[model samples]
Target: MKENVFYGKGMGPVKKDYPDIYEAIVGLNDAVYTGKALDYKTQKLIALAIAASNSDDRAVKKQISSVVETFDTSKDEIMDVLRIVLLTSGMPPFVKAVNLLYEVID
Candidate 1:
């Protein structure tokens, strides 16, 4: 399994220092990412939107990178997600997310 970029550096420390906790987190991720109702790509897009909505620049960039690398997610798909962020989260976060998206993709 690929390391979740959202977890960043903290995950390595947690996994090294607290193996049980890391495994629990990994289990939770496995459960949550199951493609039952929505496919993994859709789930990732939703996650990207959430990251954008929160104005989390690092998360936005990492999510974009991970999604694109893992799923070959297209720019248009990401733009659609960013559209939602624009409506629900306003211009600032949306702009930040768009900028980060370009940084990662282009």
Candidate 2:
């Protein structure tokens, strides 16, 4: 599995390195289960939008790639999510996210 960006390496060891915290978070998975309500395609789109809004390039690109691989979602659909993020999250962060997305997708 890929390491989490927040707790991995240069970010320093926090809850990720602690077995108790990790287990606690893992146990809390039931609190926010995504299930099959939106389907993989829609879930990826929502994830992309949220990542973009939050200015998380790694997460945005990761979700974009996952959507491409799993649901065969196109670049246009990913861009649409970015557009929505721009509307909700403002220009600067969205620009950075879009640049990162282009870097990965292109």
Candidate 3:
């Protein structure tokens, strides 16, 4: 029932059961993806960073895979985001993200 937020697919029953919530979530996604202050790639990296900070493996992998596939995002650029996590979220989450990153990118 959980949608892949990146592709705008996989809404499952949410579209039929909770139309309002689904629309709001879709709207929020649109708002976040708008290129106002940060560019799209930068925003995606931040999203990956947030996933890392939360230690959410599914989200972390999804974001990582999406970035790698969608953009010409470099390994170093991905590391740059993880490096920020190392500073703010500390070693655990940073390590988790880095490990997952290797799995996804490799």
Candidate 4:
């Protein structure tokens, strides 16, 4: 399985040192990201929104950077999601998401 860009540093050793567990996690990720009700892009957006809403800086950056790197998501599109973060998650999370967005775009 290819490494997921979003996996945290805590997971690095798990992938290298625990091959079976890493395979299991990769399978689970495929199950979740395979898109059922929503299409792939929409699901990714939802994931990004959730990450931003949680105010997890690394998660937010990883999600945004992964989308930009692995898919065709645009800056305007990401900013739109961050706008929703502003309304639903409040200023701190929204600002942090926006900051990460800029860094990713650059």
Candidate 5:
């Protein structure tokens, strides 16, 4: 059985089951932070949008926490970014992101 990446609740079997692939992705994420392509605030906003677009609630929550800690962005600004993501990525994903944000921010 695969451990859940999201809530500690049970999830089924792993899909990829490839440790090397996971490591590569982790490495790439670290690489992205090596150069300051964008300011921390902008990156946080982008991460929020991307998580929303991908309908990844865990990532949305994580990114929201990062934004709150790193940039000290207000909740309103985070909501605004989520709204923009909704405008582009549609309602369902936006709703998921909003729910995740609420769970984290609360």
Candidate 6:
């Protein structure tokens, strides 16, 4: 199994069956998450937005939980990102993210 990249739902089989690919994914995760100019929180917020925009419920929840545990993120901060999702990805994703945020936070 993958020692890194622990948030996804599909990595287990990939890790067991395709160790080389899993390592590459881990490398990519490290490179992407190691913020350059945006800083860690900003990068995570962007990831949250992307997850929300994609309407990925599991990813949205994971991102919210990770953000909450890893940073001092406020509900307003997450709502701020969701607002962008509302405008760009429409009401469905925005609403889903809002609900998931509540589920994760409360």
- Candidate number achieving the greatest TM-score relative to the actual structure: 1
Better of 3 and 6 by TM-score: 6
Q: Give the per-residue lDDT of model 5 (tens digit) for 1-106.
A: 1111333122222224756656565566566554377765786588679988999777788788877876677879999998898899999998898888888778
- Listed in order, each prediction's TM-score against the native is 0.92, 0.68, 0.86, 0.84, 0.67, 0.89
Q: What TM-score does prediction 6 earn? A: 0.89
> Weakest 10 consecutive residues, lDDT, candidate 4?
1-10
Off by over 4 Å in 5: 1-27, 34-37
Residues 1-106 of candidate 1 have per-residue lDDT tens digits of 3454435668888889999998898888888888889988888889889989999887888889889989888999999999999999899999999999889989
Error of 5 at 67 (Å): 1.0
lDDT of each: 0.87, 0.68, 0.84, 0.83, 0.72, 0.88
Candidate order by TM-score, decreasing, is 1, 6, 3, 4, 2, 5
Mind giving the per-residue lDDT tens digits that candidate 6 earns over 1-106?
A: 1125477667899899999999998898888777678788998899899999999999999889888878869999999999999999999999999999999989
> Residue 95 in candidate 3 has what lDDT?
93
For model 2, name the residue pairs that clash.
none
> Highest lDDT: which candidate?
6
In model 3, what are the clashing residue pairs, if there are any?
none
Which residues of candidate 6, in runs, are more than 4 Å off?
1-3
**lDDT of each residue in 38-59, candidate 2, tens digit only:** 5546755886788788887677
List model 3 lDDT by residue over 1-106, tens digit each: 2233544345757777888988887888887688789878888899899999999888998899888888868889999999999999999999999999999889
Q: What is the lDDT of residue 70 in candidate 4?
A: 66
CA error at residue 51 for candidate 4, angstroms: 1.2
Ten-residue segment with the worst summed lDDT in candidate 1? 1-10
Error of 6 at 34 (Å): 2.0
Q: Where in model 4 is the C-alpha error above 4 Å?
A: 1-6
Q: What is the C-alpha RMSD of each candidate to the true structure, in Å?
A: 1.7, 3.8, 4.0, 2.2, 6.2, 2.9
Q: Order of candidates by lDDT, top first?
A: 6, 1, 3, 4, 5, 2
Please list the residue runs of candidate 3 whose C-alpha ends up more than 4 Å from where it truly belongs after superposition.
1-11
